[model samples]
Target: MTEIRFLHIADLHLDSPFKGISSIPQSKWKEIRESTFHAFTNIIEYAVENKPDFVLIVGDIYDGENRSLRAQALFQKGMEALQAKGIPVFICYGNHDHLSGKWVRFLLPDNVQVFGEKVETKTLNIKGEKVHISGFSYKERHVLEGMHSHYPVANGQHIHIGMLHGSVEGNMEHDVYAPFRKNDLIAKGYNYWALGHIHKRQTLHNDPPIVYPGNTQSRHRNEQGLKGFYDVTLTENNATLQFVPSSAFIYDEVEVSCEGIVHANELINLMEQSLNSYREANGNAIVELTLTDISEETSELIQASSKEEWLSLIQESLEMDHTFIIVKELHVNLPNMERKESNMLLEMMEEWETAEWKHVLKDLYRHPKGSRYLPAIDEQFMDETMQEAKEILSKVVTRGE
Candidate 1:
């Protein structure tokens, strides 16, 4: 009846260029760039302080297909910190960080045990308790075959945990890498399942605690909300899991009402207040503001030649107490104003519906590189966008009364 404690994290994405976010000052980008490292550092510190039996990084320790030496060094540093504290680490590489010939040169700490390219099991004794863990790493970029069939049954009597870095069978949002059905996992008879590949944290099953700890850091706006790891305590009777927040900056989108706002400074004030509220709830955050019900003055401000500069100024001004409220992009969704579709817009819509454009769009959606972050736009959504365009055009035709 002994309890086992460990830290579960995935997708640190070290040295992530954050390709999705663009058009900001280099100084700001530099600060934001360090966020992933900061998050990884936090996880290491927590492991050392808490002295967990082991740390499990399910997959995607690095961001890009080609691993960088700097990212490798930083990862080793974290491993060293845990090793110094007598904590063991288990790692499995996902599609993004699959093993390559280059890894033959990079060395990891002795305390770390990385799974190979085939499904295998490792047995360890922690605090006089025997535990059996099983998993595998992707040898190449794509692992379309079902590896779940290869997972052996749990060893008799020892605590069993299964690790997988792949998408669920029905998850069209992600590539079908190492895809497995939820029932397939349940059939394995493992005490717990640690999943990766998907950046969002989710619990697939509660009884045996099948979970995805999510990524340690958010790389883009698409990965919004609190990004961190899970602290799990397993007992003979029940398993308890707690989410520990370690991300340096939260990414979020906030909408502000400007029904009667007359001055740009007033808008800044409103945004600051909203940012403060977010900080209270989420610690520190990077925000994208969408202003609604914009007055004519605000509309004019939006159309002005210096709109980008003004937005940057607002972002710069929002900095206070070492917290940032960076407006990644500003959207002017004016209320009662027609989202007018001009002749050019109609022409573009027609082009979008054409077979050529559709084919291109599908290719982008199905691209292995993009499937991780960019969700495919569904047919219903495209239809809605077209209808909205027509409504906007009608409004434009009747405006200025």
Candidate 2:
């Protein structure tokens, strides 16, 4: 029986700076970026502890175009830790790390084996078993053709594993690089398939266990969820995969409703309470609060008050006792429909008032040459009308005084 285990990770996107981090205060930016490095350190520590047979990095070792040397050095150091334990590393270049003539000259470590431009397989003899690994380097940013089409089938008595970095069957909003289908991998007859590029953890086939371990750390909001890598254990032909959490700071979207919150202070209190609850649940996670279903009264309160004041209040309240927590505030004013239907007379008046403005404005900008000036003129007009509409609509529909 061939018993082999390995850590599967991809889309590290190392050395990539967090969006908007630089815009923040210099001190805050340093802290945020430090947290990013800390997350990476956690992953490295996990690798050192587990010490798998080998580590398979699918792709995106660094952010493309402006890849950082510091990131490359840190990644090399992390891999060196695993190498110290006599473990080897396999890498396949993704779109971010596209093989260019300039980058080709950089000498990689002896323990690191990167796939060539063409799909090729290499066998590693481990404990009287043949572990066949095959992958291809991304020649350019976008590859329209299927990379898997060129992959060879499982040869000999080895456990065949194929590593790739591309979307399969064109995943949502994913770059159509090296596009392939589910049936394609099954057809290839590889015992295991390790994929990258898409930043969400997914298992395509249970029988063969084709999977994408996702990014080691999330780079943005859209890539939200539990971010981590996978640990796979192979015995003969069967494989078992386990996902390990390696992110240092968790990002969460918490929704706070203003259902019964009529006063601004009441709303702030509720928000503080919600923040406290989220912190308890997430344990030092960074939170983005989405204040939804806000009433017109609430909207007026927000407009009357300074947004910076509200944010400062929450931030201060959150940090009162907790020393190491960061709270990012986002305030949204969603119109309350129930409040709008309370006054019938106000509603009718608003309709008539809006109609009068529309008619006058339409005639003023209705000339044949209107299209030329419409873009600039229409914007201001829309803004004024929207403000008027909000004021009238709020008074007419508000159920409460």
Candidate 3:
């Protein structure tokens, strides 16, 4: 019953441009740009302190196809730290950081084991217990075939781990690269499956623990909440996993209800209080403020000719803690006035929900070039889109009347 511990991290996305946060001052911009490196350093420091048997980075060490020299240098530095500690690091290059003939490669530490562009297996012996790690790196931008089928079955004598960097079957958010099914992975009889390429953390299956550690740092609002790695401990009979937060900054959305706020001062006060709540929380976070259930006066302030003036006022009065709750953008959703069933806007939404709407868009869907970019106009999305359109229409109709 030998126990082995390892850190599982994926989608480091080192040297990301931080395009969304580019509007900040140069001083702040420099900090944000280096945030990814800071996070990777944290992972290394954590490994140094914990002395894990190995560190597993599933993929996408660099953000783009043409790897940046700085990113490679920073990654080598982390590997050097682990190498000094006599710990091993394993990596499988993902879609974004896939191998290319044109890449100017840098030498990694001796202790680092990077899977090649073909499916391969590496064995490790820790404390007299044998462990088998199997995976491959992407040779090109997209490895669409099911690579899981090529994975070797786990020999019962050793703990087996599978490292894969691709989308699970049917996940449309990401391109289908190295696509695999949960059942296929389970059938491989591996003790654990380490997954990557998806930025949102998820555990597809728990029996043998198919885990996606997500990305080390989130660059966009779509990627919200805590971003970090997983500390995994495996024994002959049991496996345990604990999440470790490594991100220096986070992106979050905070919604403030303007239901009762009468004066602008009162609204500002409520927003300030909300911002204050993030002060003692984990790390620095940029928040997108969304004001819902807003009163008619606030609606006018947001939509009238004085809209820019009101926005400037809100931004100016926003008392940031300088450490937390840094305001980024504001979205105002005006309260819907009580309307009768026969309201024109409501009737319009009902019409949008009808089959006739699909018929109207049929030509657009059939267009050779336009259809590729458009998502299949499914009923659920149609319902949501129509409702959103109705909200905008209601606002305009109310104002016009």
Candidate 4:
């Protein structure tokens, strides 16, 4: 009975073009742009220091199929660092950085073993223990086939790990790629399942230890809190898992109560107090602030003074503090629609919902030259956009200007 340790990280999304975070100028602009790179470097440093038996990078190593030259260069550098420490790395390309993508393809160190476009197993003998890893790389951007079916069962030797980068079937939220279910994985009787594609860390099964390490860094508000990898220790009998936070910055949403607040000074103080209480939040954060439970007078006053003005004020106040907290977005949620003709707003929303919003969005992205730069339009994105649109319209109608 031998115990082995490894680091499981996925969805690094290196050189990710962090859209929506920087609609306007930001403080520490250089750091914001390089946060993704910083996160990967931190993970590599941790591995170099701790000296793990091996490392597993499941998928989505780059932001896109056509990975940027900088991403490849930095990735190679990280692999080189691990090679120096005698740590072997296993990798599989996800839908985002599929094999079909065109790139100069920087040469990685010999310590790195990337799975091909077919389901295959790589066996490694480390520290008097045998470990078998099974995985596959995405040959195309859309891997609609049930590729998980191809994964072979455990070799019944020492340790068996199955690495996959795809969404579970029946997941309407994310596009289906190499889709499979929990039962499908469990049926194979693997020791552990290391998964990617989803950007929030979660554990599906505890016994066999099916898990997703999520992404290395937080790209936008949707991916909140500390983002990092899973430190896994596997024994013949059980598996112990611990999450390590390594993201340079985190994207989070902070909600403050506006119940009894009236004046901007009070609002400023409340926001400041609320902001201070986010202790778990890393030093650097791009917060999407939501002001909840507002009075009609407060709402009116807020509208009278432009929303941008309030955001600017908050942004300026935050800059005074040492912590780099930038209020990238401000949403004022009205207490109740007690104003006149509020029914019309609801009607408008209903109509908008009935209309082909996705169709309209598809048309907007029809231009090949322009579509390449657009971020993915998932259900969450549409919901957020719709909510913001409603809020904007509600402001216009409620103000009665």
Query: For each predicted model, how many residue pairs clash, with residues at least 3 apart or on different chains?
Result: 0, 4, 1, 0
Local error of candidate 4 at residue 399 (angstroms): 18
Please report how far candidate 1 places residue 395 from its true position, in Å.
9.4
Candidate 4: C-alpha lDDT: 0.85
lDDT of 3 by residue, 1-401 (tens): 58989999999999998767653434467777888999999999999999999989999989998888888888888899999999999999988888873567888878999999889999899998888999999998878889998899886778899999988899889888999889999998998999999999999998899999989887878888999999999876788999999888889888888877767677778877776666455457777878788767766545654544554555555433354346677767643433432276567656665477778788988999988998777787687877787777666757633
Off by over 4 Å in 1: 101-104, 295-306, 319-322, 339-401
Per-model C-alpha lDDT, please?
0.81, 0.75, 0.82, 0.85
Please identify which of the two predictions, 1 or 4, would achieve the higher TM-score against the true structure: 1
**What are the candidates' C-alpha RMSDs?**
10.1, 5.6, 8.5, 10.5
How do these models rank on lDDT, best leading? 4, 3, 1, 2
- Candidate 1, backbone clash total: 0
Q: Highest TM-score among the candidates is held by which one?
A: 1
lDDT of 1 by residue, 1-401 (tens): 47999888888888888754675545578778889999999999888999988888898888866878878888888899999999999999988888863542477889999999999998889889888889999998899988888999875588889989998887878787999988999998888899998888899998788899888887788889999999999998899999998898878898888777777677678877876777787777777778777767777756664668767776676654456556788766744344333656667775675465457577676778876786446677677767887777867656532
How far is 92's C-alpha from truth in model 1 (Å)?
1.1
The local lDDT score (0 to 100) that residue 2 gets in candidate 4 is 88
Highest lDDT among the candidates is held by which one? 4
lDDT of 2 by residue, 169-218 (tens): 85677777899899999888878899999888899998888899989776
List TM-score per model, in order.
0.82, 0.81, 0.81, 0.81
Please give the distance, in angstroms, between residue 212's alpha carbon in candidate 2 and its true position after superposition: 1.0
Q: Which of candidates 1 and 2 is the stronger one according to TM-score? A: 1
